[model samples]
Target: MRTRPSPRSRRHRRTRPRSAIRLTAGFLAAAALLVSACSSGNSTTSAGGRVEAALAELPRSTPSGLAPYYTQRLRWRDCGVPGFQCATMRAPLDYDRPDAGDVRLAVARKKATGKGKPLGSLLVNPGGPGGSAIGYLQQYAGVAYPAQVRARYDMVAVDPRGVARSEPVECLDGRQMDAYTQTDTTPDDAKERNALVAADRKFAESCGARSARLLRHVSTVEAARDMDILRAVLGDRRLNYVGASYGTFLGATYAGLFPARVGRMVLDGAMDPSLDARRLNLDQAAGFETAFRAFVKDCVRHSDCPLGGRGTTPAQAGDRLHAFFRKLDAHPIPADGRRLGEALATTGVIASMYDEGSWEQLREALTSAMKKKDGAGLLSLSDSYYERDADGGYSNLMMANAAVNCLDLPPAFSGPEDVQKALPAFEKASPVFGPGLAWATLNCTYWPVRATGEPHRIEAKGAAPIVVVGTVRDPATPYRWARSLAAQLSSARLLTYDGDGHTAYGRGSTCIDTAIDTYLLRGTPPPAGKRCS
Candidate 1:
């Protein structure tokens, strides 16, 4: 379970280097001479053949209205990585025109350790759609993955275009983001409801005005194409990948397009690519409800539980949180010179809802907020989700999150009116979160670009065996997504962890870890729907 701090502010930072492909005006002249020299001997196939073939099949057609690519040098510099240097790659701002404007993509890698032989580069994406893969790799994956998995492959990470290290999409600055985090999402009246709608609209507008050029291009389809380019430059015949959370959607996209070139893939916390936005949000709402019930069950046994009383029941936990949300809306608390309202409190607590590790912190934060009228702890947790820094600058998480989400599928609701219409179904799915999250569904209603795509099933027929891991009580990527993805893929093996969290592999399920490790190291898939306690 990933535990983040409250919403504050932070700025984006470029973290990695692209492969050694230089896109310059001197390309055609130098390419002819180099090709002649390289092909002089056998004149047929070599490692370079893999590179040529990979690039030949890429989509040359970019979207019609996309901005032209603007060429950039990407100042290459050292990033304190040992035996690994950092640089950047520039690709077309739009894939249609290779000679147009370009955008910088940040890439990173720790070279394969074994010198005897190297299989190839293995790319890893920790699924946020907005989550910084480089940061996730540096912080955990690079060091923690099994040695057998690490020894034969070079571990690589790329912040997808419009994401963290890649020319990130910008929205509100830290202070403005602070206001967004505090905006009331759940309303008790028409006035409060209108306010919520306004806040969401403002957020959409901010992203549009600031990241207009990149917003439409941040779709999962485009990101998968970018990965293909990276694969070409890395000199790999096939793509080896491990994706979690939203990354599952990305990996699946790659498989959908290039199943023939697929290698070992592990999708943890998989998203159901077939679900429409409304269904996705509603399912996630229910997932959170499931996780909260688990927490409430645990809280009932704790002596310090503030919400449970002699008359309280496990079922009442949802109502108790709902009541507290109402109270905070009526009167917000002050925390560290910031106002903590129901929206922030709810977002904060929900942010912690992803992983069981943070449940204790959530309990403490909720107790303080409910009993002492202090909202600082909850605020901190929400800030972490938003990737806000202490000084009040904002990272590009929220910006990229909305950008990718908006492009991947049509908005869940057309407007507040549509959201209201869907409320009944959402509430039926999740009494605790349905109403507010249904409204949250309206966040992308005012997206700058019309959605170019819609949710559809991905049947990656020719792809190699892929492992799909799911947690029964995952809040963000529900367990059903894992089931759905496995069903979609021809060779998918489902590994179910009867646990709580956003993802299952590394969050302390022996059964989950052992199964995944065996798959990655030995190329053996766990049985379909294999359940772990």
Candidate 2:
């Protein structure tokens, strides 16, 4: 499945449906010139009570047979991205077999700029299961983050294994990816269905052919282990982190694996790890339906809405959009060398859903495509979603996304029959998005590596209270996930942003921002049931 937004802010925008998360900003890197912008645990505890839940003490000793990794020193050099320093750290390729081989991870940081000495490193991850932490660091977090927080904590990011700059997983070349993106997910005939099946198999086989070993090692658990080693190398007593979307899952995994090592942490756009692959896919499908409903509700108020007028119901608007997708299924819209088929156009629409900042652009793009018979605008958005450069190159975003997702959990569907069985539920969840997303789930059915993880709770017992932020209308990581995660974490405090878009923290809610700022700065999480709009 096409993972979130290719826009950089959300991770799992996919041509194929898969539950993946990544940083928000990566998607916009290639298409920004076109499509523009895009809490806590503990209920009932008073602010005083929360502060009393201080950062927990961590064990000083390293685990057995891994002293070399734990004690490995780093040599920082200029990252060539002014003001950021880069270094490489080594982690065991297989934690289960530390001596078999090792993988080198790229790390980058922006030192604290404030006057006195800094508190410690605050690690940041923009959760692409495939998103590049170092990329997010250099591009957004390291530079544009809050000044007050930056002054006290040295900002750090590490490219998880098999992501960008960290031996990224590569499958198809640019041309092949273009074809893959154009494949129809809502097939109308046996021929089209078989074609999608072939595409899915080819993609998995290509990834296996090119990145077999990396694929086997790129699970989130391995990445979490790498983070622990990074924390130790950074000389931090505990991990202070801000992980978004899938990053929340990563942070939660860290907390669960090493509870005593937990520190001040924020998981924005939290994903519930307790659900299996099928449930996550199903829930995400429903989440997109929710976002689309919100979009249609607002879209109808605008005069330029392509779907409907002021009095049109959201259901009616969805019906129109669904019909339009059906038309594209029969007759694709030409956009430069490539065409905007049902798949790409749908992806373009979903990309705009990540952040409402692009809603205006989506409106214009839709107006042109539906009214003027042009597809360039939507094509640009799709390209951005895939991180496809103008030069016809692709980032390993999709490849890494699939690699991690397939290994993180077993396939959501074992074959086309399974997809067919899930169709009704998927369609009911998101009439405009469900079928394609369900079919998208089929991409992993042909994966090479077996799953290394499974659905389970991450209690992080005795860990410091974590701030879990959720956007009620978040399309990718549904808000309910945040609630579930918060309830599961032993010391979690849930923070709600009753607004649109993906992650909540830096998206401009004063209530949300101030609450997180105070927590990251003073280690006092938001009080239970704190909701921001």
Candidate 3:
């Protein structure tokens, strides 16, 4: 959620309308287990044309200022998993000149504890670009994976640079963040809008001030290279990975840079590297609109829903919610000694937008806000997105999110004028989402970094079998990204999860799980373009 300058956000409606905004929302592990599974390890291919060619295409490493850094030998702590021990990996602050400063990536592993054979290490990244790989390790990967897969491989994860533990991207402090989060996103006039613009400028300034050195180096390409170094250090002949969401981008980039080194890989919730800035943002806005429609249809069925009632169509329900947002914009409700305004309310709604399991929670939050005028529950959800602490301190998620996003591509818009020009197209794609998202997409226009990456297809020609997963109704990474990515990668397979939610790996689809488990454990790729309900 990077902030952008808005001169129009300050416009107080001469007469306020009702509407609402919604909120929106990584990791691998390792352990040593030796097991004889149904599948056996494939012989590593010699570095030759395919893999070596890909590596040859990579840009020379830039100076990352990561010298003078030392890997901290973490006392392996058992995180309740029998074979898994967590440690931290340290690399030079700048990989180009390893003699410079260093950064620490929080790493964890479950040792292979099986008989007959071993498949080396399998690294997992739960997408966030900022998501805690270590957290994902302890909570899910350590236990839930199929025993066959678990037994044969050491599960490993390292939080990427500028992510959870690897020298996080620092930005605004708590109070400033609160103000930035609450800044009006919807504007009716020039004055209110300028305030929004100011907020974005301040956020960028804070990031530049606090994390200038690291900000320039947090691109997905760089992160992928880091994984290579980690792979080398781990002594794996080839890298095996399971990446979700942004992790998919990282994994794909890794394959593009070091194709010959790729072993078996799974990229869930794949992002289309082929889509340009405006298209990506517009498509995501439409994706949220799709998810919102699904939520509305579900909400109407529940008797307790606040926005759905007599004659309330899903479209109307959406309208009412939007109306609520407008009302909140002018007169925010008080909650927890803070103002619970449209920005926070929208964030809360968007947070629940990721998973249908949270629909009931969203309903309750909306009801409380509508009926009692209390917005604490909703505010808390938004806070979770911002990774804000109770004391108002903020994590570096927003900062890193902005840095990576800005560097990945050019700004979607130059300013409000640019957005206004694109508004009709966006609104047509998603009447419920167009305006705000169009404006939101403009944040990169104010970014300090000149975008370096573009939306180009990453073929990673001749890479080993890679599986690309898509959740049909995912708000952040739409299903089409999977299709596009699969088409882009020469050896990619598209595994479709025709369901709701952000990513589809362990979200209870037998089809998704079985196919992926088989690939991870048995090296049998899911048939290309396979559909799962």
Candidate 4:
């Protein structure tokens, strides 16, 4: 699960509310798998008009100090899954002082398979701020993208600095992370709150101790700059890309910094760059509420509904789920030596919200925990979100997620006192998940490095046309974010999917697939206000 920033101007640092992690995990997973399943591998016409125009508009000379970094060559070799080649590219650890040191980035690509002349390379990021783009490409995108697009454009991905296989930022060991995930996010007393604070401080201190030099330089701004260098290294005149969830933020930052080089870009499950940490958390809490209501409506229609019956209202269903959580908080269900408490149960529920297909699994998990006292189901879901392997090891997803997020915006709260003051508003947004999420915002307050980026708009004024896709009931990156982002970008086209789940494209929506495919293949975005259900 990735952390999300909040809104309201203040001196506090950004943290990932519990809700934010739930939402981001769902979308990040969906974005990686949904499109892969729907891609039709068949030849199609190429979109040739925009590339030339975009390339012609690029600046004649690279920035003087950055030329060497951008011009460096990559030595590709066969690695990971078959039909894929991997390479390592060197980027300055600090852009301001290129001679100081360097960070090695992991890059991978699958050559175009089309019969005609290739358009160029198309880069993809599956969000997380921590999610592995190389893993996503090798596992999904390279083989799943529409055969037409895959045939013409080489699909590429680079693990951002401080992310997976890119000098990753380390935090707690597996056992420690397991404990962290089980920590009580909603404190009932000062003691519990202090414990939470101590845990966060420990997490920050660990990262600082082990990754001191890289901590301050892992900001999203730095990652965006890295993308520019990757663009030049790949010999692409302009960037052609697909970014989802937090990846949308990275892609937008790139466009803002290099507007003239923007080519065909698609941002799904978009994040609004204009809001601060507090507002982002509150809005995301509300978004989860909207998705939960939708889930209840669907759940109660079936006879096996865990929360309520067919006659129960969504509000009543939410109350029942809340009651179940309270029960678990007091007496956690046993599962594989670990107990399923409110934290893990709530996470398990939130995990299912990202994709509708997970609803059945959630239902079974809830039933087992509520009726049979078996918590393995929900615990399994929580483990999946945390990327916990069967052998008990963890990926760097959570660490890099926190590293990038904490550096991108101010913390949502200064301390537990601030969280106490904000509880009512958060509860008002989501009675089921609000209080825990509000308290979860304290994670970044104790960070070792101060934030380097601030909340701002990204207009990308001179960029070519960009497509912004939003799901009406998206649990993580809300639909409103897509609307706001489209409004903020000078040349953005909004494509709405009046549906459930996080992102829209290739998630069983033929209408959405056609519109996005048209944009990618023909360089003609769907008309503004286009709606797909």
Can you give the TM-score per candidate against the true fold? 0.85, 0.90, 0.85, 0.90
Model 1, range 1-533, lDDT digits (tens) per residue? 01111111111112111011000000000011111111111111323232111111223343443322222233446668654445576666655555556777888876778644676878988765567777766655676666666787888888888978899989788777777667666666799778777877787788889888887677777787678767766778788898877777788778866777788888887877666666677777687788888778777777778769545665687888889988887888987688788777877777666666677888899899899988899888766666677899877766776777777666767777787788898788778767767776666677777765554556666679988888788776778888977887777888888877667766667788889877766678898668998
Put the candidates in TM-score order, highest first: 2, 4, 3, 1
Output the worst ten-in-a-row residue range by lDDT, candidate 4.
Answer: 7-16
CA lDDT of each prediction against the hidden true structure: 0.67, 0.77, 0.69, 0.76
Taking the tens digit of each residue's C-alpha lDDT, what string does model 2 give over 67-105? 999998999999888899999999998876899998989
For each of the candidates, the C-alpha root-mean-square deviation to the true structure, in angstroms, is 10.7, 7.8, 9.7, 9.4
Query: What lDDT, from 0 to 1, does candidate 1 have?
Result: 0.67
Give per-residue lDDT, candidate 4, residue 394. Answer: 85
How many residue pairs clash (N, CA or C atoms closer than 3 angstroms) in each of the candidate models, in the order given? 23, 42, 78, 16
Model 2 CA lDDT for position 22: 35
Q: Alpha-carbon error at 133 in model 2, in Å?
A: 1.2
- After TM-score superposition, what is the CA distance of residue 425 in candidate 4 from its true location, in Å? 0.7
**Model 4, range 1-533, lDDT digits (tens) per residue?**
12322210000111111112223211121111011111222222313221111101124477677778888889999985888999999888987678888999999999997787788989988777787888777766787777888998999999989988999999899998878877788788988888878888888889889899899888777787788889999999999999877788888878876788989999988988666677778888888899899899889888888888888987898888889988887899897787899888888887777777678888999989988999999988787777788888988877877787777777778888998999999899998888877877776788898776555666777899999999999888889999988987889999999998777765778899899988888889999999999
Residue 40, model 4: lDDT of 25
TM-score, model 2 to reference: 0.90
Better of 2 and 4 by TM-score: 2
Please, what are the lDDT tens digits per residue for candidate 3 over residues 327-385?
88789997778888887788788777777777888899999998899998888777766
- lDDT sort, best first: 2, 4, 3, 1
Name the best candidate (by TM-score). 2
